[model samples]
Target: MGTRLVPSGRTATRLLQAAIGVVLVEGLLLQNPGVVVNALLSLGVTFLPPVLARDWEVRLDTRLTLYIAVAVFLHSVGMLGFYESVWWYDHLTHTLSATVVAGVGYATAKAFDEHSDAVHFPGSFLALYVLLFTLALGVFWEVLEFGARLLATAVGMDPILFQYGIDDTLLDLVFNTAGAVLVALFGSGALRPLVESLTTRFDRSFGER
Candidate 1:
């Protein structure tokens, strides 16, 4: 895999990509330009670190990143169309959507990596890891939404409040945790080996061997 670094050119390229994403969201996707821009900006910030630190295996990570980008973009499109007015509740729903997407993305990446023999972590351990990671990410996303509200308020933009009550946030955490745990538990057993065998076969057929 190539080294992950925030090369100046790459950063510029990412920004350009983000700009193009904004255009697509606004045009083809029929989302508000402002909403699309906001979502893309957030996405760019989230992805920048991985691109710079290059901590993840590229083959799997690239797919994970794309999944996240598309999910977030679609979530933003939905919010813009449905909400029309940004409320705290709207923000909370958006956060929920983002968290769910991210959790699924991580699980998918782990599954693919295991199939490809690109990485290995014990199934039991991976289950715990996924649970913990999902919970941590839930908290992290809340913090991000809070920060976004603050930034918007500071700039005299409409303040998006946390519409979901504290109880709702807790519920979201529970659901997010459940989703990851379920995937890890079911996926790590018979599914992992089967997937690996299939992937091997497919790769062999295509002269990847």
Candidate 2:
């Protein structure tokens, strides 16, 4: 079966939350309150897009919301120890993170155009920008992970709390690129609608320009 390019509707959102809920429960059982906190923070980010609801152009749509939800859910599960048990969990989360951030970048650019009435980028150019933006963010994320690992060691916590081995790090980058390219290629159809229409415009306002 073909994978759903973008998950639509509220049902998908609920499923994402449910999955995370399961992971969160597991974390609680394991007596790791920090894991629960991380889970909540992740969920909070997923829901934060609505704060921009006053501007319809940049408001997160169902697809982007679901993307963020899934990425966070996967990461939460990994935090709760599923990444080691399930094996594919970390790979999937990295790939999903790349795609999610790139989609958000694309939507933000489109929203800026609506506000500034500036010249708009064509679909491909927008996709490239999103791809690069996502990759840069992904790299920065890895850096944070590195820093977390160091801090953990300094404090006598798990030195690998946020760090992965070189192979895992390289794999994450590779998966990130794969996800970015997928969005850059298929995003016009799959990712664009996550940006809601401005008051007077079509669902997309750039195709004719």
State which candidate has the highest lDDT.
2
Best by TM-score: 2
Residue 154 lDDT in candidate 2: 84
Error of 1 at 78 (Å): 2.7
Q: Write the residue-wise lDDT of candidate 2 on 1-209 in tens digits.
A: 01222445567877777777776787678767657766777777656656544444345555666667777877776786777777788888888888877766776676556545446777777877887898899888888788878887788765334657788888888888888888777775664455434422432454433
Point out where model 2 deviates above 4 Å. Answer: 1-8, 54-58, 113-118, 159-161, 196-209
What stretches of model 1 exceed 4 Å from their correct place? 1-34, 41-57, 61-70, 81-121, 159-163, 187-209
Clashes per model (N, Cα, C within 3 A): 2, 0
TM-scores of the models, in the order given: 0.48, 0.76
Predicted candidate 1 versus true structure: per-residue lDDT over 33-129, tens digit per residue: 4465656565664465355334333222333334345445545544454444543434445444544444454445454554555557665666677
- Candidate 2 has an lDDT of 0.69
Question: Clashes in candidate 2: how many?
Answer: 0
